[model samples]
Target: MEQIVGSGKFTYDVNENWAHVPPGIEMKPAAVAVDSRDRVFCFNRSNEHPVLIFDSNGDFLMSWGAGMFRYPHAIRFDAQDRVWLTDEHHQQFMQFTSDGKLLRTIGEKGHRSETGVPEDDFSSQAWRQVTHGGGPFNLPTDIVVVPNGDMYMTDGYGNARVHKFSADGRHQFSWGEPGTGPGQFNLPHGIWYDRRGRLLVADRENNRVQVFDLDGNLLTIWPTELIGPAFFYVDDEDTVYIPEHNAGMFSIVTLDGERLARWGAPIHKSIHGVWGDSRRNIYVVQPGEWGRVRRIVKYTRR
Candidate 1:
């Protein structure tokens, strides 16, 4: 029999063979997103097929995005079912149609923000200094689109700030700096905008999730001892999914910060991202380790 995991309403039966890929097709999944039809979109690190699509039953449907991304980091679907992708290597995030057509782009391609370090400073000290000097974006991470079409993104890789942008990609305001304080963040990696319009930020290095209002004001803080929380996802009922990268597990939490259930151990290759479908089935993406390729595990809620 398959192993069961989680507790109470979140209990699930693990399905290891959820996604069957063709042999020789290597996948280094950076992020995962579900569309309106419940189709799974695996954003990977392959120049040939950067986007891999699968039905909810784990059947491979199709693939696209050849020569479209330098580095695929995160994928998100907005209210209109438009796909948003963050390419850290290109230092930009873009919106696209469900069929894989590029609709818009939001940053200078390959242009990184200045870190205020000396030209001769190539040592570790210089690297630390550059990270401390918060700028527009050193390597921006995830993005959250609001109901009104506004957007918020975390400058995570080399900075610790979140910038807000208008629907058309105009900078409205920005907030944060590198620290462990309430409003501060150290590698604010993942972000999500809940139905109530509250912003949830997975402050990875700080070991906490910070909540904020639409105006970028600090509202509350949800702390976790889990190693690295790479991303955040909330179901329709407001259940939050926190994927801990290093600890090799994820906790299902309430909006009030209560951890209701936890799952994943064998799929721990490296939990980079996660999302759920309308049927409450959870999907976890492991970018794979050593020489292995990426894989997505599905857990059907019981």
Candidate 2:
């Protein structure tokens, strides 16, 4: 019998071999995104062809982005179907055409902000030293572009802030600090500008989602009972999908943060990325930090 997951109207059967990886090719997917055509793009950490493209039905279409990234983190599409990618290790974010042509690159490569954290300090307690917010990024995790072409990024790992930018790549302003307060953040891992005109930030380490206005004003909070809410993918109907890392699970929530359904696997943990197609089929990917590494899963709607 095939493994089935999810609940309520969000259930699906796992398609383990959804992507036909060519011979001698591997997909160490860090995150996933879909274009207007619902073409699946798997932004991975591999050295060769880190950007893997696939058809809606799991056929391998093409690949690109050879030797262009280190520690690929998040991949998202904007209103124009352009690609936005974040790389925490490189301490930068980049923009690309859907075909993998580099348009612009942000952040000074190899430069980390002075967030009171040491080099190579991955300790849990290290974030406590972030006395205040910083500029553009210091190991930024995820990004989002609003309808008006404004951008927001969760500068999580090495900093505790959400940096906003203009459509032309100019720094606008930033918000957040290191603490457990309403507008504060522990690790602002993921950011998404929902259709409701609210910025949903996955404040991962704090175990909550912080909703804010476009101008960085705190609106509300959703203690959606998630662990390590790494990233988000909001569907057309304003339904929210998130991959919770520590819980090894993903959740389906309404626009108001009400849980519709949630599911996880015993063999999976640290699910960092999640997206879906028009067919309602779900796609998820994983990295090696928690348990499993280099895995991309597809769950077809039933």
Q: In candidate 1, list every pair of residues with a backbone clash.
A: 27-294
Q: Which is the leading candidate under TM-score?
A: 2
Cα lDDT of candidate 2 equals 0.84
Per-candidate TM equals 0.91, 0.94
Candidate 1 TM-score, true structure as reference: 0.91
Which regions of candidate 1 are displaced past 4 Å? 116-130, 266-269, 287-292
Error of 2 at 132 (Å): 3.1
Where does the lowest 10-residue lDDT sum fall in candidate 2? Answer: 286-295
Give the Å error, residue 174, model 1: 1.2
Please give the distance, in angstroms, between residue 298's alpha carbon in candidate 1 and its true position after superposition. Answer: 0.5
lDDT of 2 by residue, 1-302 (tens): 68888877788998766788898777788899888898999998788978999998888888998888878899998888999999887878899999988998888887888787786765445566677777766778998888888788899887899998898889989998898899999989999988779999998889889999999999999856778788999888888998888777788888778898888764567788888888888788853333466577888988
- Our model 2 lands, by Cα RMSD against the true structure, at 2.2
Candidate lDDT (C-alpha), each: 0.80, 0.84
In candidate 1 the C-alpha lDDT for residue 102 amounts to: 91
